[model samples]
Target: MSKSIEAVKRKGKAKEATIESKDQRWHCRNRITLVFGSNDVEELETYTYEDGKLNFKTVDFHQAKSKAIEEILDNCIDEYYRGHVTEIHCELSEDGKSVMVEDNGIGFPIEKVPQVYSEFRTGSKFKDEETDEKGFLHRTLGQNGLGAAATCLTSDEFKVRVRHYNSKKEQTYTFIDGALKVKKTKPKPFKGHSGVRVELKLSKEVYKNDVVDEELLRKRIIDLAYNNPGLTFYFNKEKYHYKKGLLELAQRVDPDTAQEFGASAYIYEAKNTKGKKVKGKIDLSVALNLSKKSEEREKFISFVNSTPTFDGGFHHDRVRRLFVNSIKDKLARNAKKEKLTLVDNDILTGITFTIGVTMPNPRFESQTKRKLVRDTHLEKGIEELMNKNIDKFLRKNKEYLEVVMERAKSRNRFQELKDASKKARKQKKQRVEKLLDANERKKRELCTLFICEGDSAIGGLRSARDKLYQGGIALKGKPMNVAQAAISDILNNQEFSDIMASIGLIIGVEADVSKLRYSKVVFLADSDVDGGHINTLLTNFFYQFWPELFDQEAICIAKAPLFEVITDKGTKYIETPDELETFRETTKLKIKEIQRNKGLGEMSPEAWKHVLSRESFTIISASDVSRAKEMLNVCFGKDTSLRKELLMDEDSSSSTSVSVSSTTTSSAKKKASKAPAKKAKAATKKKAKVTKKKATTTGKKKAKKKTTTSSKKKK
Candidate 1:
C-alpha cells in the first residue's frame, strides 16, 4: 500500500498522521481515478472565522518528510519535457509523442516512488545546482513539497511510472483516500534501466489567461533545446508559432571591404567565493547591420546569470560606468576636445553583453529569476569587473566606435517615417481583406476639442462660436510618441486620429495636425496649478504635427476670471480681486468681500458663458521665441520639477509663478492684468476660503429700527 502523511493543526499544537493519497486526490483535482503526488514539504493550518473572515488559528509544518518524493517528481517532469537531454540516450516511439531514456541514473525505487508522491514530502535543497548551496535560485522559494498537490488543483488526469535497478518487487497504485492502493503489480524488468516518467494534461484552470502559458512554455522548451546541446532531448510537439526575433540583421547594404573580427566588447574580472582572485568573462554579442537602426547607440544588453537588464537598473548603471571608463582613453584619442562628457545614452545603446560571474550566494530579484540586483555587494564588484575587461576591448575596437558615433550624430527623428515609406513602396503582397476589416472600425465620433486658457478674459467667446467653424478652426490634441510604432499601429491607434475626426478634420500625409479643420479649439484647463503644463503639451503637439496652423493664428486659448464678488445690489467677475478692491477704493464705493474662482466646472452653465467666453478673449501674441523654447522645455521638458523650483525661487529677479498659463495677445494686454501672476505663490501658500456676502435690503427691519429711535425721542 502506498503511504501518505497528513499535516493537522489544533488549537495551539500541530499533529501529523499517515493517510491514503486517493481520497485527498479530489482535494487537489476533481478526478477520483487520477493519482495525486507531492515532492516537497507540507504546511497545514486550521482557520477560524470571525465576522465572515477566516483567520489561521494554528499551523503545522513538515519539512523533512518524504524528501525523496519531490525530487523524483521534478525529475520525471524535466525528463518528459526535456528538449535536449544532457548526455543521456533517448529512444522515441512511432509518433515521437513519448520517449524512454536509457541512461537516467538512479531512478526512484518503485516502492519509494509512491511515498514521494505522498503529502508532507520534500527533497533536500543542498544537493541541487552543483552544490549543497543556500540560494533561492536552486531552492523552490519556500515551498513545502506540495507541487503535486497544486497540480491536482488544476488537472486530475495524470499518471506516473517508476523503476529502479534490480528491484523485482514492483508495484503500481491507484489513488485512494489520501493513500494509494498498492495491489502487487508486475514490473517490466528492463536492462541497464533506472528512471521515473510522468505524463499530464493541464486542467482548464491551469492553462487559462487566453493561452499565455502556451507562449511561455513553448519558449521554455525552445530555450532548453538550444541550451543543453549535449543532451538527447526528444521533441514530438508541433512547431511553436512566434516571430523568431532577428538574431542577424537583414541585408540593408552590401559591404565593399573585408570586415575585422576578434575584438571583444567587454571583459570582467572579479573575486569568487573563498575570497580568492578570479577573472570573470564578459564578451559582447552585436549585430551591426544597417538594418538595425542607424541611430542605435549602446544597444549592448547586459545580463548576469541570464537576467535581461533592459531598463539598466541601479546595478546595471553601476556596471555601465565601468564600460565607459575603460574606453575613456580610446574615446579621448578620437576627439580634439580634452574631455568628453559621456552621457547615459553614449555608454549604452547598440551594445549587448553577458556578465558570467561566480556569485555563490545567488540573491535573485524575484522567484522567477529574471534579474539579479546584487543586493549584498552593492554591485561594486561587478562594476570593477566590467571596467577591467571592457576597457581592454575598447582599445582594440576604435573603428567601430567612430562609426557608431557618426551615426548617432547623423540620425534624425524622422527615420521611422522614411522606413514606412520604403516598406509601402515595395508593394508587398496586399492583404486586402485584413485591410478592409481594419477600415470598418474607423467610424468617426463627435467631440469638442478645447484649447482654452491662452486667450485673455474669455468672456462671451464660445457663445458666439459658429458651429460650422470646423472649416476654419484648428482642433487637435497633443502629439504622441510614435517612434517605435508600426505604420498600421499608428494609423489605427485611437489617440492618433480620434481628435482629428471628432473635429471634422481629415488625416492626410501632407496635412499637419494643427492645420486640421475643426468646429472649435478651446483650452479650458484649470486656472491655477498645471495650467501652463497642459497648455504647453497641447501647443507642442500642435507645433509638431502642423506648424502651418500657426501662420493662420487658428489656435486660441480661452481665459477665465480669477475672482468673483457679491454685494447687496450686484455681483461682478474680476480678473483679479485685488484690482477690484483698488477700483472700489478709488471710486470710494462700499464693497463686499471677494472670493477666488476655483475652476471652469465650479461656475454654472450660465456663469460659464459669462466667465469663459472666447470672442472677448485676446489671442496670445507671438513673441520672438528667445525664451519660448526654454519655456516649452521647462513645462514639457525633462526637469519639470526643476522648472517648478526655478519659478518658486525666492532669489530670482524675473521669475514669476509657474502657474501662469497664458501670454497676452498684445504687449498692452500683457501689461494690463499682471496682478494675478504677481500674487501667484499666494495660491500655493494658502488655499484660503472666502465667502462673499450678498447684502439684503430688508425694508421691515429698516422701518422698525427708525420707529424705535422715533419712539425713544418722543419718550
Candidate 2:
C-alpha cells in the first residue's frame, strides 16, 4: 500500500490503459489453441490397423497441428456428404513439413476461392435449418465455416486451386506469411473433372515444430475412408476403399468375431426456421468385435459426422449405457438362476465397438471436435436404434450371451478364492484341530502325512507311526470330488479345510514343495474296494489343483495289510491274497494261525509296524495328463452316463471271471464225486476176494490139524 501511494503521488494520477485491435491472421497465429486445440504435444493412447491386426500404442499427439490438417480434409468429407465427392487424395511431402489435399467435387464459384480460404467466418455451411434438394436436412462435417479459414491464416504458405464445374473456369491463389501477401491468377477454362486442391505448410513459429506426423496423417486418412462408405481415398500412393465402411474396419480388428450391432439409419422430422417441415436423417453404423478369451477392458472407436471423436462424449455414453441395459435385461433370468450379479465390466470386457454417426448440425465440446456434446435428436436416434435392433443382435449372438455368463461366473469364483485365501491365511497361523502333527518341525520336508480312512485308522496310526517323521489325519468319508464341486463348497468342507491347513496349502495358489509341511502325502485306507475308491478320490483332489506335487513324486500310496499270519519262524504281514499265496508256496516254516483284517481297525500292531517300517511307498504318477484328466472325468464328473459305462465295463469283466470260476468248480465237483463211488466199489471187491482166500486157508489148516491128531493118537 505504501509503494502504491508513493507511485501515485509521484505520477499525480494513474496511467490510462491503451486499447489495440488485431487482424484475423494475427489473432489466429497467437491464439491457435483456442481456434483448434492444445498448442503443445501430448502423449495419446491410440490404435492402428496393420497386417490385418490392430496394434495399440502411445504416440506424441499435437492436437492443434493435427486439427489444422484435418480441417482441410473435413472440407473434402463435407463435399462427399453432399453427394458431390467420391475420391480424395492426400500426400505428405518428403521433408514432412507440408501437406496437400485434393478432392474431386463440384468446386464453388472461382471468385470466392480467396475469401473462402483467408477470411474468418466467411464460407458456407452456416445455415443449420436448411434442406437439400432431396428434402432432407443438410448433414455436413463443417458447420461454423472457420476451420479451413483458420488453418489458412495459421500457415506459412497457403495455396488453393479451384476448377468450377458450372462455370468451366479455373483459378489459383496463394497467400504468404499468414495472408500478409496474396497472389492470384487469371481465370481460364479447365479440362479435367471439377475439383479443388489445397497445399499448406504450417508456420513453425506458431506450431513449435512444423513437421507433421506421417503415420498419424495416414491413419486419419484411412479412418475417413472407413467412415464414409463408397468413398475412395489415396494417401502416399496407397488406395483405401470400403463399401461396408465401419463394418470392414471392425473386421480388420477381428474378422472371426466382428458383426453389425445396430440398425443402419434413423429418420426424424423437424421444422426449419421458416416453419416448413423438413426430414433429418441420422445414419448410424455400429460394428463390434467380441472376444470370449481376452481379459482386456473394452475399447471404443467412435466418430460424429466424419470427425474422429477420440474423447467419446455424449454419443458414446448414451450408446454404452443402453447396450449394457439391453444385455442385462436379456440375461437377468439366467444370472438369477446362477446366483450371480453382473457388473458392467463383466458385460463389456473384451469388446471393441466401432460406431459412426452422420447427423445434421452435430455439436462438439470444442473446435477440435475430439469429444461430442449432447444433442437431443442424436440421443433419441440412439435410443430408437438400440430398441429396434438389440433383441435381434442378442438372438443372433447366443454364444456372446453365454460368454457374458461365463465371465460372471469366473468373476464370482475369483472373489470366492480371494476370500478363501484370507481365511486360509488366518487358519495357517493356528494349529489344525484334527491333525496329528509330526515332531519334525525344523525340517518339515522330512515329514510324511498319512491320510487315513477314519478315526479308528488314525488311532492305530497314532500308536504305530514314527512320531518324528510321520503325521496322520482322518477323513470322514471320501473327500469331495473337486471337479464336481464349486470352489466355495470345497473350501467350506471341514476335512478339506483342515487338510490344506495342515499341509500349508492355499487354494488358487501354486504349491511350493519346499515350503509344504510334508514332503510326501500317503493315503492309508482299508485294503478293500471302498478303500481303493477313497484313494482314487484323494488322488483326484490333489492332482486337479496341484499337479506339481505329483510331478515331484510327493503323492504316494501305502498298502494296508489285509492278513497277519503267525508261523513257527516268525510273524508276517500280508498285504494281499496273492502275496499270502506266494509266501505259503515259498516258505518252509510250519503253518500256524492266520488273521484276516476286514478293515483298517481290525489290523494288528505288527501289521501296522510292518507298514510303517517300509523304506518307501508306491508313488502315484501320471505320464499323460490328458488321459488322466479324461479318466478322472469319467469317474468323478457330473455325467452319470460316463461313469455308468465305466462300471458296466467293470461288471462285465467281473461277470466273465465269475462264470469261469463257477464252470471250473462244477467240473471239479463232478470229478470228485465220481472218484468216490469208484473207490468204494473197488474196496468192496477186494474185501470179498480176501475173505474167499482166507476161508480156503482155514479149511486146509483144520484138515491138516485133524490128520496130525489122528497120526499122533495111532503113535
Candidate 1 Cα lDDT to native: 0.40
RMSD of each: 29.0, 16.2
For candidate 2, write residues 1-715 as lDDT tens digits: 4655443345467678999999888889999989998999899988876776778788899999999999999999999888899999999999999899999999999999878988888878999987789888899888777999998898999999998999999999999988889999999999989899999999999999999999899889989988987899999889999898889888888899899987567888888878888899999878898888888999998889978999999988998999999999999999998899999999999999889999999989888898998988888989988888898898898998999998998899888778878887777777787899999979999999999999999888999999999999999977888877887788888898898999998877788889999999998988776777778778878877787887888988888888888999888888889999999999898879999999999887878888988999988777766766766776677788875554435342233222112221222233345565777899999999999999999999999999999999999
**Candidate 1: regions farther than 4 A off:** 1-103, 118-121, 126-149, 165-188, 205-216, 237-321, 324-341, 352-361, 373-388, 407-715
lDDT of 1 by residue, 1-715 (tens): 8777877656965567878665444554443122222212344332222342324344332221111122222343344322212333323345423223233544556765554555434433323232223212231222344555444234323345555645733344433323433333566676544554444333433222111122223223333222222333343333322221112111111132112212232333344455554433332322222222334443323333222332345455555575566555466554444223434454445443322222333455433233555444445555544545554455656565765454433332245445544543332223322110111122212212454432322222344333323111222233443322344455455443444443433322334433333423455555554553455555655444444455445456655666666666566667655777676677544457666767653544444656334453343333434354454454445555845554544443244322222331122123224444667757745444221111233566788899999999999
- Give the worst 10-residue stretch by lDDT in candidate 2: 656-665
Worst 10 residues of 1 by lDDT: 244-253
Model 2, which residues run further than 4 Å from truth? 1-12, 481-492, 543-548, 563-595, 621-715
Question: TM-score for all predictions?
Answer: 0.35, 0.84
Measured with C-alpha atoms, the lDDT of residue 242 in candidate 2 is 89
